[model samples]
Target: MTEQKRPPRAIGASGLSCFPIGLGCASLSGSYGPSDDDNALRVLHEARARGVTMFDTSDKYGNGHNEELLARAFGNARNSVLIASKFGNMAGKDGKVADNNPETIKAFCEASLERLKSDCIDLYYIHRIDPAVAIEDTIGAMSRLVEQGKVRALGICEVNPTTLRRAHKVHPIAAIQSEYSILYRAEAEDVLQTTRELGVAFVAYAPLGRGLLTGAVQPGSLGDKDERLRHPRFSAENLPKNLELAQAVQQVATERGCTAGQVSLAWLLAQGEDIIPIPGTKTLSRLVENIEAASIILSDAEIGFIASSIPPDAAAGLRYRAEHMKNMYL
Candidate 1:
């Protein structure tokens, strides 16, 4: 078999060069279940060895345990990789709260730096915009971190075009992290355009649709403790309908002689050069499969066909329930 070639380069807004494919660390912190720290460390090491330079994590993940885990995994090699962690989504008295107060941002960055065992974070995001606080105020705090040499660049997660524009005025956003996949194209078609116009990189989280596009999640695959089980799209009624979309992905994968996950990721990479898909997985084999997608190039016609097969609204159920959805795209 012939070895497939990887895609061309995409530069982040901060001028940091990275592989078009990134490794999201959400699943590594036990999003699905109790994750084996040793196995997670091995996966992170394996991904770095495979040329994946961008690593995405969050302070809220495992309540800071994830950052500590990355510290152990990267150790001295931390400088070789770009660590992207988020702030603002801290749990508080009112349950989960979005806080971008200058004090909170400073405290979060310091804590994250300590947890990651790094002197500076490569890409630091606000995580979510605190609706109560102005976007400029939040970004102003992030900008200070850049001036202080504690953060390399700024990023915002799940913000719309308007919020992005407002935030950019305060600081040049190096990247905008959002949920983008064949299963979710609403933002890619619109918000992504704005990011492109602003010279900001689009970091796609859950690029494989939280394991749905992988063809590995069947009905009742998630445990009761799994947060995905409570998501509307993964609910019993919507599971069958969503599985139909996965079937279409499977058919396309069969034609390409690759896993459905690979086909889905390949299609995302084909979207544009500025888009980087960070698909998360705990297993080494799955991580390898996700990375190999970077080399699976699809022709224009193939990309169009896949897009038509799974239109933005084709998937069943809302991406998130009302409460959770409200927290996003602010």
Candidate 2:
């Protein structure tokens, strides 16, 4: 695949710009399967060479191994890249899934900075909203990071419009990360509306539906140890029906003269400039394919057809398991 020549996309009003497509570094730390350190470094370097400035990871990913990996890849040329890492998802002393205590936020930032080996994080996000904590208190603490120059911008993941509005008032949230794809559009479209109203950018994670829209991962094809196996979207009853939705993408790809993954990404790029998709990959070829997707502009008619092919709720299963659903989109 060839490199794209598009201009950088801005992250809200934070004065930060990056390639339209960023690299989500979760898989590098074994989110899906085992990974090699040297091979992961090659992929990161190749992404940088292809103009992907934004590298997204989380402290909970591989227990901070992901951040340390980025530190090794871009420690010498930090200015050339945008490091977007998250906190609040890792379990704290109480054994909870989220930890958004104001006092802990600063300590989390310190630990992430140490792992990343960087002076300041380009974009710091609350990986998950803690229902027990007020959004204002969380954002208020994050704002102080901006004041102290420890973080350049703030973001939140799996946020709803009301929580997003409340958080924005406490501190300007530059972005919101969430699972957004053609198969799952209900919440993300609602989010786009609020983000447009507030000037907050949408960082789309799992833009490919965790590979359902990629056309490569078929029903029952995932390895036993793959984390995606735990997601309800890939369940025994759901995978077949979901793959059927992906077939729609394959049809569009055929008409567009590109791969299914490229067509899926191109349709997303056509949504709006404020939406940025971070599709993670462990392969060099896929990194190039995703970067090239930024340049494939679909006609309005094609975009509409793709959207209609897979309706908002066409997805077969929940975004996550029943036990974990309560914590998402809070």
Candidate 3:
């Protein structure tokens, strides 16, 4: 919809590249709320048609329905684009968020490859770290996948500097996927410093602050099945405060002649060439708006103004709920 677009961004030194903003496919599997399979396929097809080169997914999304959806949508064209999926991030009966067992890595990759219907995955990641397992052991297992030619590159999600360094020692980590946006850069900035030093690309998920920066998700508009209802950032107590802070983006959008979501995404793009924002949407118009965000180039002054408008620690609530917060950034 926009008249401008940026060049392809590289993923570390992995010899792979993608469009500036990619598609985050979690919502397609009904992570946020209820999703229709027919519409989900349409959205994936539209994203590919609109030049979204990267499609981020996880084995945990809809119990692996998401990968199947991608396979069905792309079919013969699956290899043309990048599909970055993850494993061991599912919640167990104990309510923990990881299962990075070295023993099961092969089985997971084999199953993911089967579900993806692809001979080799463009990128693979550890959805989350299992504290009980040694980082070296898990990464070492992943590195073997590369040796066997099953994966093109490796990545880690929700990682810290120390853990990243350890993982890199085992293998060259091409990218780091984390929550990043104007409203939630405290962790992203900290991780960016290390990623830049290590020459690792940063894949930013939740670039729109879980739709808060879009100025459309009202307080009571979330469906009963929506997962945001359980997030602290979307709590009845914290939602208003966070939305108030997000108004700064809306003001900038008004001045810049674009949607608030565009400003939010453009601000992320302004962060650096290594940063790629993957904002997701089930609606076609919103998807187009996200893709067009790559075209927006903010001035130096505007970028600074937007950053100061929402301080690093100004957000009122935690990224995840109290229980899940314990496992992030490890």
Q: List the residue pairs that clash in candidate 2.
A: none
The candidate 3 region of ten consecutive residues with least summed lDDT is 1-10
lDDT of 2 by residue, 173-221 (tens): 9999998989988999988899999999999899989988988887778
Per-residue accuracy of model 1 over 1-330 as CA lDDT, tens digit each: 123676545555687868879999977888877789999999999999999999899998999999999899999898889899999887777775888887778999999999999989999998878888888988898899999999999999999999999989989999899999999878667898799889998888888898888878889778776789877888889988888987878887888788999989888888888888999988999989888888888877777888888889888988889788988887
TM-score of 1: 0.97
What local distance difference test score does each model get?
A: 0.87, 0.91, 0.91
Task: Provide the TM-score for each candidate, comma-separated.
Answer: 0.97, 0.98, 0.97
Worst 10 residues of 2 by lDDT: 1-10
Scored by lDDT, model 3 comes in at: 0.91
Over 201-242, each residue of candidate 3 has an lDDT whose tens digit, in order, gives 999999999998898888898999999998888888998999
In angstroms, the error of model 3 at 230 is 0.4
**Better structure of 1 and 3 per lDDT:** 3
Query: Each model's RMSD to truth, in Å?
Result: 1.4, 1.6, 1.5
lDDT of 3 at 195: 94
Rank by lDDT, highest first.
2, 3, 1
